[model samples]
Target: EDVHIRREVNALYVYAFCLPSCREYLSGSKGEGFLFPWSDLDIMVSKLPPEEISMESFHNDCAYIATTNGCKPGFCKLIQSYAKCDYYSRVEFLQLKQHAGFNVNFDQTIRGPCYSTNFPDGFDCCYALPVHPDSSNVFLRTFKTKFWNGVKLEIMNKNITVMHCVPKGPEKGDDDGHQWLISFSILEQNIVHSLNHVQF
Candidate 1:
């Protein structure tokens, strides 16, 4: 019984923001029993839309709908940025403190990795903001698969860990919101690239 519950917590952790120690599982709820099956896939995305999507309307979609056709209402988080430069080039940022209500963290800090200033057209990781609770002016991600539902399973996916704020439009600066950035995995060299200005 104990072993079964452990697996549930770990699986949910992969999809949601949770603390192993803090989460308490119940008999049939979040505590015990198999909410679904066992699938081994780990994907950490920077939260985003279907690519080529912008930040402005992204928040509207989330705020407008409580859930997608196949997603939990509160499990997803948005990651976006409001930079005017070219993706992570010193742009406005979101205040996670104001949105998430509490506070959340990423696997790594979004800045400091020394990317080029004159970025290439593609090859840039989508800059990301933290998942905020307001669902207003935010970036986001959603889980499409549930263990117990549907069929034709294809797990094991990875996404570009969106890194910086890349904006192709006006600069709203900090106060307005840095929720314009979103990112996925860099599986291929097809996202954004550096322009050679920050050469080594």
Candidate 2:
């Protein structure tokens, strides 16, 4: 029991520091502290719209360099042509912790919902997705870019989503017959949190 609590508490703190602006709450069996060797730890993060996020110290020159030089370290890539922010990958959670000046070793994976439906082009789905670090390294991190005041960009790589779709079905095909869906975990979180403490 002590070991389980210790592990959970440690993970919770790491998550808190990793995503300061995100809301952290308990929602599953682990949150209730009733099981050992759990399959997954449920952590709910508040999803913010693209308007609320921005990338700092990024510009066209940065993207040009990244594109020309192939997105090297200390550089960024422009995933969207008209996006107000720049996307930064190849950095890991440990690197961010170091940037924040902390010495701790804990690894956890927080996930969200993905589904299938029909998607239309030029439409803004507005869903927040978990951006995983480069898969090459287990400790690599991901960030979401946002701009503040049309300047002073803030780059947060931990939890951000993009608007994209994938091939659905077994053969991996796309035909627009209910093969895509927009994520709604953020709405679900709002609904769940609305419950009173006793009900929660």
TM-score of each: 0.21, 0.26
Each model's lDDT: 0.28, 0.30
- The runs of at least 3 residues in candidate 2 whose Cα sits more than 4 Å from the true structure, single-residue gaps closed, are 1-15, 19-28, 31-37, 42-79, 83-172, 175-181, 197-200
Q: List where candidate 1 sits over 4 angstroms from the true fold.
A: 1-10, 15-60, 63-182, 186-200
> What does the lDDT come to for candidate 1?
0.28
lDDT, candidate 2, 1-200, per-residue tens: 45356546855774666554443444355554445563345544433223121222223322211221332232223233254454322222223433442222122211112111222211111122222212111211232213122111211233223221111112233222222222233323334433444554
What are the per-residue Cα lDDT tens digits for candidate 1 across 44-156?
A: 22334322233323443231112122223322212333422322222333233123322332222232211212222211122333222333222323434333122112112
Clashes of each: 31, 14
State the RMSD for candidate 2: 16.3
